[model samples]
Target: MTPPLALDIDGTLTTPSGRIDPRVFELLPDWDAPVVFATGKAFPYPVALAHFLGRPEFVIAENGGVAYVDGETAVLGDPTAPRAVVEAFRERGGEVGWGDGDTVNRWRETEVALSLDADEALLREVAAAADGDVTVVDTGYAYHVKSPAASKGKALERVADALGIATEAFVAIGDSENDASTFAVAGESYAVANADATAREAADVVLDEAYMDGTETVLAALRERGE
Candidate 1:
């Protein structure tokens, strides 16, 4: 069986601005392996991306809370935390950012990007209210909180299981903190030079280029595997 190719969207398949090269899209469908878009973005984005690339077998969305397969959207994991959780956090002065809910984005979730002025006490309260199940990530700007079950790694595992591909026969490419866990199970993982330091540290190899030139980088790695 062809290996599963799990590609991250933000900084791996496209530029930081979220633009995909048509050339890459052209090459993707012909690839023998199954392709999955593992991303933190909403489900629609990856689904549209797959449509552009002409492949729709699988697409993991909203960090992994939702999975799209064969034109059907399945909630892989429970994204609904009790309303009390959010109310409790808010009561303690933690602000919440409401995201696209069953509309254009079709993602019913709330996000937390703590204000720079937020104190540790407030953050602690938010953490306590979440019961530690929220994803608290420091993106250098602020701490982000999302569903605990949503993650790129978990989504990759879902795709691997669906395709009947062994975890060892997977290639993962990404360039951000969200991509770290997924790389752990990847047979080959790559980080672009433009990637942040955290992403570089997690990847198996760091490329000296960008995703626009990713075809060459991936081809080189494949050749090395044959050697």
Candidate 2:
């Protein structure tokens, strides 16, 4: 069997607008291997996507703060990190806005999603205030304040162990800085054309196409290799 494929959701499988093109869904059925989703997204989003794919294999959420597999969910990091980071930010007079109403954000366990107006200084200040207790990761959509222990690479390792597969037997594809961990631990790492510079640098393969097209390209290559 071909090694599993671990994918990042936003900006990899979806458009910039965060919508999964129907064409991408059309390509899913052809890939005959475990498809694990590793994303900065919270809980239900990953679970829902797995259901849609008809592959409830494994999901790494909140950049690996949470993992779901085989009808079981596990929290891999300190769940209190988000609250501590938020409080520290507030104490420093930083005005933070939560993605409270958003369905996915509302379900987050180990991280808090906050939107900023490209205020890099404020982000740095918040990180400093945490004193290395937590980490602030920018997912392009929002800043995820989470524990330093959380990592997509670690989560992927857990999934690999659960599936009785070697850690180096998976193809990881992603498009952002948070995906750096996924790329680091993957046997083969791929980045779409639209991937951020950091992600592209970490990947072994950078596709010419973006979004769903890039994903399909990787899947096609995998199929060809297997044949």
The candidate that achieves the highest lDDT relative to the unseen native structure: 2
lDDT of 2 by residue, 61-176 (tens): 99999987777788997867577767767776775665346564678888877775535577667677667888888878778888889899999998888877777888999999
To one decimal, what is the Cα RMSD in angstroms of model 1 from the true structure? 4.2
Every candidate's lDDT: 0.66, 0.82
Query: Can you tell me which runs of candidate 2 are displaced by over 4 Å?
Result: 91-93, 98-104
Q: What is the clash count for each candidate, in the order shown?
A: 0, 0
- Tens digits of per-residue lDDT for model 1 on 130-195? 666665554333444566766677767767777777756878887778777778877878887766
Overlapping backbone residue pairs in candidate 1 total 0
Residue 68, candidate 1: alpha-carbon lDDT: 67
Which residue pairs show backbone clashes in model 1? Answer: none
Looking at model 2, residue 20 earns an lDDT score of 80
The alpha-carbon deviation from the true structure for residue 206 of candidate 2, after best TM-score superposition, in angstroms, is 1.5
lDDT of 2: 0.82
Worst 10 residues of 2 by lDDT: 95-104
